[model samples]
Target: MNKLSLFYLLVMVALIQISVPAITVYQNEMVLYKGSEFLFKTIPLDPSDPFRGKYVTLRFEEEEFETLDTSLWQRNESVYILIDKGVDGFARVKRLSRKPMSGNSNYFKGRIKSFYLADGKAIISLDFPFKRYYMKESKAPRAEAAFERALRDSGQQTFAVTHIKNGKSVLVDVKIGEISLKDVVSESKND
Candidate 1:
């Protein structure tokens, strides 16, 4: 740790801090299980992506919609959103889905969703913008577990979740739940 080396290390740390993503994650970032909320970590896992469609994007993280802005909402084309627990324990978030779900709990179901971090606040973007991320700092045990799952679950690294706005990732939210890729796709179909 010579003076120059120490300065380089300090600069690297600063860059890392600046480059980290901004997101509100659940406990352990392992909200993959339906009841995972029963146990959680304030921190979440890193954000990732394989690719996205032209009109939509997909997300897989330790935490789902965590924090959100309820002002921007619609009921037609899917929009991304984060659910902030209202006083009633019923989740409330920005209406990301283009159209509201008719008798469905998941409006943006099947479609890709994103949680954006802006102005120290969070916003979500639904749909696809291609492979992009902000890689938030999630150090929870669940985050690690989710990461391991991402790697070994698919026998490959399945990245976390992140949202991009104007070509720049604004926020990233880790996903959690016991729903498997098949289950997530089928869960909405059952509805």
Candidate 2:
């Protein structure tokens, strides 16, 4: 192949590699927002990465699933978690199943990272796909500090706005007691 042709090919390949995942993520985000909304509680552990910019590490409280039959469950097995609204209207995992439940139930899929039987209960830990929310580089640290302070002082709750559709899940936003970090930073800037 000619040098120019080879160079163009390389460039096209690189662009595809980079853009495909981004496009897929964007498409999934669209589906998620239009699908079903859920809320999951979180703890603030934001840290800045030079390459990845700034992101908050989300540790979900509802990562564990309990089942009566541990024998059928295997580590790294794909599991479907049915979601339901709690009394507070936040989405929570109703149950874990080997198969996705039909009807009006909303569900997301995850892999079982670990499972064990204890006291006749099958406890499963999942590797949820949506775990981090990338944010603007400048705003992350400030938001993280403010979120941490709120968490420690007033016992504030940080919850993630999660969206799920067709067994795929995406995190939409992280709210520090109902205020999104983006809004928090913007308001702070205005004030």
Against the unseen true structure, what C-alpha lDDT does each candidate score? Answer: 0.37, 0.80
Residue 171 in model 2: shift from native, Å? 0.9
Please write out the lDDT profile of model 1 over residues 1-191, one tens digit for every residue.
68999999999998877656422233213223222121112222334444531111233332344344444433234443323334633334434444444433322232334455666555544443222323322223233454455556665433324332211222234333433333333343455
Clashing pairs in 2: none
Report the lDDT tens digits of candidate 2 across residue range 168-191.
Answer: 788889898879978877776776
What's the C-alpha lDDT at position 64 in model 1? Answer: 46
Question: Alpha carbon lDDT of residue 125, candidate 1?
Answer: 41
Per-model TM-score on C-alpha atoms: 0.20, 0.78
Give the lDDT of residue 6 in candidate 2: 98
